[model samples]
Target: MEVDLGEPQMLAIGQLADRTGLSVSAIRFYEARGLVTALRNRGGQRRFLRSEIRRLSFILIAQQLGFTLGQIREQLAALPQGRAPTQQDWARISRSFRNSLDERIDGLVRLRDRLDGCIGCGCLSLRKCALYNPDDRLGRLGPGPRLLLGDAPSEPAISPAAAIGSS
Candidate 1:
């Protein structure tokens, strides 16, 4: 059903949950996390604008895209609060994710390209498998999956074995 914002449709909490396919508790959690908000009726029941369906949908889709709740909340928080977000507002907010999404896609592509080789070569035994890790080294590159992240090894991995033989 189309929400007529001009008509100012208000949905009860349960109705919002039913429409969004989220449990009532999950909706409350989102509210607590500052991802969405709800008002209280005269009887103290939770009430949500019908437009909240779209807001909750964005949260679900952003999570599916691998964004954490913090990230999603931050993006959504950029919009005007206490009101339904306009399409332009949503478009601008979603655009912020584009760069990170591209990076994720690139990482996935690299992983897919190397997966067969990593599995088939059986290089883990060598401990020096080119596909596994040519050098167990720590580079100037900060923390994280270094090789998988496409960083060249800046320095050889320092190990007690290397130190014992060197001395």
Candidate 2:
């Protein structure tokens, strides 16, 4: 039951499950998917290297970032067994995820800017706003904002002169 920390040790399935906070079934699933590999005992039970703990942790973190199992596998493929991941390997993976995170942040910023513009414009109806009618040709387009908001139609446009001095 005592693990020797001085040497490279192999752990049983139960111990690995406990150490990784993963169910035995889930560990087996990872093994089957080639995300983690284990050696077979003479009795055919699986034995995992202690390093698998770190690998499993990485897998969980990658999954949280919305990477598919296949994508994680592809990223991890660059790492070899019996050696820690090199700086180059880490950089490559980091670059891939960084690009994805940057894209998500850009989209959120764009959405926030659009919402801020709507607030400043005092336009409750998205369909009838000037921001929605970028080209000012919604009438010819037949029922909808053609350029900006591009959602649904609003009330018909009234002439500016008619409403200028009216109470």
Candidate 3:
């Protein structure tokens, strides 16, 4: 249950699972997915380096943020081999994920702004609203309230205020 951060220490699978809060099978799954690696003892039981705790923590956090195993693998591949990651390594990985995070944030902000604009309008027509017809470059795309703001015409010069407020 104890991790010696200063030295390269081996942790039994159970210890690793307890520390990481992942089931043994889930830890094995991560290994199979190449998110973690462990050495086998002479008896063929898996033994993990203490560093793996941090790695598994990162994997779990990334998965919570909607990253696929492949994306997590790609990010982990950037770390220096045979050593714990330096702050610079972490910064580099953060930069890699920053763009996607920013895009998601920006999309949410746009949706929030749109929702604020729609509160009084009450258009509720998908065909007319840009929120629903995002593909037309007139509305926003994706599933959700944005797509159901109002049924606007396929090709009309209707202002957003008019579209949502119209009866």
What TM-score goes with each of the models?
0.72, 0.59, 0.67
Q: What's the number of clashes in each of the models?
A: 1, 0, 14
How accurate locally, in lDDT, is each candidate? 0.73, 0.68, 0.73
lDDT tens digits, residue span 1-167, model 2: 96555756889999999988999999999889998889888999898888788788889887876779998898778667664455676788778778777866665565665553332223335543444333343555553323233333355345556435431
Model 1 earns a TM-score of 0.72
84 Cα displacement, candidate 2 (Å): 4.4
Top candidate, metric TM-score: 1
Better of 1 and 3 by TM-score: 1
Rank order (by lDDT, best first) = 3, 1, 2
RMSD of each: 7.9, 8.4, 6.6
Weakest 10 consecutive residues, lDDT, candidate 2? 144-153
True-vs-predicted CA distance for residue 128, candidate 1, Å: 10
- Which residue pairs come into collision in candidate 2? none
